[model samples]
Target chain A: MSWARPLVLGRLVRLAWLLPLAAVGLFTLISLAPIDPVQAYVGDRTALVGSDQRAAIAAAWGLDRPATERFGAWLGGVAQGDLGRSITYDAPVSEVIARRVPASLALIGTAFVTSFVVGTGLGIAAATARGGVGDRILRSLAVVLSASPGFWIAILLIAVFAIALGWLPSCCAAPPGLTLAEVGIGDRLRHLVLPVATLSVVGTAPLILHTRQRLVVFLDGPAAQHLRAHGLTERRIAFGAGLRHAVGPALNLHLAGAGELFGGSVLAETVFAWPGLGQATARAATGADAPLLMGIGLSTLLLVFCGNLAADIAARIADPRLRHPRP
Target chain B: MTLRARDVGLSFAHPGTHPDHAPTRALEGISFDVAPGEVLGIAGSSGAGKSLIAAALAGILPPAALLDGGITLNGTPPSPRDIALAPQRLDALDPLATLGRQIRRLGGRRTDPAALLARVGLTARVARAYPHSLSGGMARRALLATALAGGAAWVVVDEPTVGLDPEAADRVMALLRALAEEGRGLVVISHDLPRLARIATRVLVLQDGRAVETAPAAAFAGDGTGLATAFARRLWQAQIEDPAC
Candidate 1:
């Protein structure tokens, strides 16, 4: 099939509709909240401020305008490369987030790869050893971990490794370095250990469950038995024959969970004090920094959409069954 | 080489049963043999252990299946060099790969795919097609090609003619007959008796997991003249009763 035309059309349509609608959604959420943007910006008690002062602060922040006008202005400003000003930082929201994207991606990227490899490997092992003790153990562990919250795991890691064992740092992504470059790779990696562990633990569950379930269906079927009869080893039959079938579903489950993984990431980042977008978003929410919150929301949404696209491309590339057009 | 399964017994735990439940025997006292250059057809109704015997011979019995005896080729269990099975399910071929790569996976790095395809009555164009793209006959040929590439002494084919038209079935059986002519033993499992009678040197009748009777292919003729057992005669009688078979 010729995909070029549909691809261009899809890109144009999504850009035309999704960006504005998403912005409106975020703006509506922030505006409808009971908290005052003036009090949020001031970060102080309302009892200490005079009526004249509140009016001035509200006017300066455009909180005095109609909802439609404020959304239009915010969208226009964003289109012009201004993501509005951060009430908490007194800096442009984009600039604050720009400094944090690399850290968030690095943390998420490492955890993503680690969780994918370990979870998929364990799932394959469990599937091949179906009805065995190892399969039961891995399955039970995944069930328990899938239900466990990421923040709770983050706290447990800190209690055990950071505080109890005194083996690792508890926070701040590298001891509050003047610049990330100033911190040695060793220090960066050390700080990465806890956050990555927390994220990977939470991320691994869905992957394991999906892979195990999908793989068992494939491996226990006639195809696998046929492969065995042809002198293929169990590993060859499992990985070569079985993994090829298992990968598409597992990739879907993993990528589908990418959004939720990042959603839970904020808690891990906050508990560990990791200087990532998740922690930044958490702070933005608490401080009522609408601009920062909007910036993170759009960025996370974009990441999730991209993840979905990756899953689509991967499904086509990995399975010839999908590459052909269905009638 | 001679592939033989002697007094083979297999049992499976009844479905939805606890560990304490008695295992139901799916195959019992099943005995058969196929010599090189011979075509042996095992015939039975559905759930009659024909597939179970094939599974046992293929060394693919599941964990739940208990076996009392074993299969051997030339008095030893078939080695990687001894046998391969062409399964009924087309999915036996990896969907992710072209048919050529799978044949090569068995035949090794330097093997020419065109030659393998040619050996199985497939065109070189088929080498590039994925498993799902191939027609039923094409999928059956691909399985046959895989088995041939393994250089095994025997090939066990399960229900090769199940979904094929008459022309396609004849094409598949012709291919099997040719493989036997090349001195490779064949064990074919199917209920298509009339067709099996054409090529099989001997046929084994399985009922309730037991081999009730074994007879020469001639026994499957109109009235089952050479059939020794009443069960075998009834099976042959049913086919005789239905001309469509």
Candidate 2:
């Protein structure tokens, strides 16, 4: 606990640098894209807007300025808590993110929690059943699931559950005409099923494999042998000492996989047309919306940093030696 | 009644090989006896199958291992409650658990963890400490305390003095001697014969995977004339004559 302050400060310090790095990197990549911001803004009416009006639009959004100057000004604005405005949404970047945050959180959080709990349980079961038919079956299933792509899985689920049986909706977080408050819990959840299942299955595979691997090695390890020799039953040894040793690494692997989880979310969101940050990211990337994309990129970086920090804290809690090391 | 091993043999199926492959005989015709209030030392060079014998006695051998012969106490195979094995490595203690928790895990509902730690010469605070905070000697004593927690009649300790300084090694030897004096059967295994001789009531010498000699601890004293087997004599000679020893 005394280590908490320093750990938080250390992570914050890293974030201070990483935010700018991501912004600059995204800015450079956006600038390089073969896209005209004006063309994207005018959309289907590009020919009708005329060059003079196009020049006016570019000037209005500061796209006429040099990339370095724009980046410097954006960085300055970010330092003062302004994330600039989204050219695509015609709103502040922060406001746009705020509007979408809940939808994204709902989907991502549900998927993440589902994967974690189910995967951990499966891992413990497979490890305890080591070398048996159950172990082989679970391991084989995990390997196959891990090898499959998240988008493909999402598409397949949509095909069977949504298209053929017509048991669920195939696209969007809500029906096409619905607004945020108009959607019922059942409606939201019904819409959530396929995307959540896809993310959970993909996320769960690595955890099952990692947890099983660590626990198997632990159960066969010296500490466990010592416990086994001391009259503790196999059941106690596997769940007690074996689980204690395996959990820290499993939590670590799962949490540090935030990037992969987010990456999978993008794919999951795109396939299901879920209105989350992943969909926003796809929109921003496609339109080459510099400010909006920069805002999303910074948010993703912050999310990853937070995940890693949580991982460090979790590891310290799980293993006391990390929290209080003896010289 | 005594703990007895009559012609105990062990062979491991050569790993990752065809079923028809010949098994490797790691230990053959190993035999010994220890009664309550006795310290029987098993000694040999490194890889002398001393640990294999310990594993077999503790019934913790891997599935690939095939054991032949009986290890019984009072004319019956000892239950896990009747015997415990303390492995050689310090890593044998659960790194994540406090010493007290691990001790209580094995001690069951009837035994007190603090009392067990006290018996092993560790303070109550040591029980609260994790394994990583412990020194080499302290970890060894903690392992001893954990073994004692189960209230077993017999304790098999492997290389208790392997990584200790002479002072610490002496203290551990005294602890083992104390356990024996409390009427517990002790099977102490080590490569360090001279140190083991101080507390061992009888010594069983092994070479390559076979027992070379079994003699009273007194036979290891003086100039080795009392040792019956030539191999035991040379072992004693090597320990006494080597300056680095």
Off by over 4 Å in 1: A1-12, A45-48, B13-23, B226-230, B240-244
The complex in candidate 1 yields a DockQ of 0.65
lDDT of 1 by residue, A61-128 (tens): 77788988977888889889899988777788999999888989898889888898888988888898
The best candidate by lDDT is 2
* Tens digits of per-residue lDDT for model 2, A141-181: 99999999887888899899998999999888899999768
Q: In model 1 chain A, where is the ten-residue run with the lowest total lDDT?
A: A1-10
User: B69 in model 1: Cα distance from truth in Å?
Assistant: 4.9
Instruction: Report model 2's chain A TM-score.
Output: 0.94
DockQ per model, Cα: 0.65, 0.80
Candidate 2 ranges beyond 4 A from true positions: A324-327, B15-21, B109-111
Candidate 2 residue-pair clash tally: 0
Tens-digit lDDT track of model 1 for B1-245: 57888889998767777868899878888777888999999998888988777777777878778988868776877775577888878878877788888888877778788898999889999888898998899899998898888788888889999889889998898888889998989999988887887889999988888888888998888788789998888888887688666
**Clashes by residue pair, model 2:** none
**lDDT of the candidates, in the order given:** 0.83, 0.88
